[model samples]
Target: MLKIISNQDFDTFAQNAKDAPRKRSHHNLHEQLDAGVQRLFISTEPETYMRPHRHSEEHKWELFLVLKGQLDLLIFDDEGNVTERHSLSPETNRAIEIPPGTWHGYACMQSGTVGLEIKEGAYIPTPQEDFAPWSPAEGEDGANDYRDWMSTAQPNTK
Candidate 1:
């Protein structure tokens, strides 16, 4: 069956995300497809902490489109230095494609934010080597500061 996404779906997703322990939820769009490509609707609250990591496999590019609310796509260097940031919203550029092996993360700028994500996948665990060593892991004491910096940081380079 073809999946349909209406405004109601987003509203429900947003509510679920808020209720989730981690302040995040996902409505999988390709549940039945189950192929190389994975697609889904992600709902995230402002408290969501997306750890800075990368898909080291060259073919694993990921794309994101903001459907509601605001998000910041943060690109970092190997040393956890901010290299670029995209403030994504319906009013601004709402889409981004992160290249494979590029250290990146996202921070929700508004509560109940929703985004569509598309990427190649085989449901494998992300390797430790792909996680940014310079960045704090999720739940670490410094993770909040890192997430905050990603949310408000300005682009330092093109």
Candidate 2:
């Protein structure tokens, strides 16, 4: 069967994200967690906190494409210093391909922001070591501050 994603789907996703405690939600297109390739539509509100982390598995490169609203993609050095930033929106730079082992995260820049994420996977959870040691984990103290800094951080400035 063919699955269709429509504007109403996005609207519902946005609403779900808004209502969720984490301020984010995803609709998986892949039927199983062990699928060789994983694809999903993610909806995020501005307050969503995605801590900087990287996929250490050799085959885990990830791609993100903005379907609506905007997001700031932040690339970090091993020391957790900002190395690069890209603004992605439907009207402009809409997609990013992140190589495996590259430290990165996203900051939602608009309400109702939705994007498509694709990655290689057997859906292994990110090992704790893969999370940036210099960054706070989700819901930890200073996470909000780190997120605020990520919103406007620039390369070489931090």
The local distance difference test score of each candidate is: 0.87, 0.94
Error of 2 at 29 (Å): 0.6
Q: On residues 1-158, what C-alpha lDDT tens digit does candidate 1 reach at each position?
A: 67789999999999999999888998987765546888989999989889889999989999999989998888888877788888898999889999999999899999979999999976567788998898888888998887777778776631
Q: Quote the positional error of residue 91 for candidate 2 in Å.
A: 1.6
Scored by lDDT, model 1 comes in at: 0.87
Show the lowest summed lDDT stretch of 10 residues, model 1.
Answer: 149-158
Q: What TM-score does candidate 2 get on C-alpha atoms?
A: 0.98
lDDT for 155 in candidate 2 is: 92
Instruction: Supply every candidate's count of residue pairs whose N, Cα or C atoms clash at under 3 angstroms.
Output: 0, 0
Model 1 residue 4 distance off true place after TM-score fit, in angstroms: 0.5
In the predicted model 2, the residue pairs found to clash are: none
Residue pairs in clash, model 1: none
**Model 2 ranges off by over 4 Å:** none
lDDT of 2 by residue, 1-158 (tens): 99999999999999999999999999999999999999999999999999999999888999999999999999999988899999999888999999999999999999999999999977889999999999999999999999888998999756
lDDT of 1 at 115: 97
TM-scores for all predictions: 0.93, 0.98
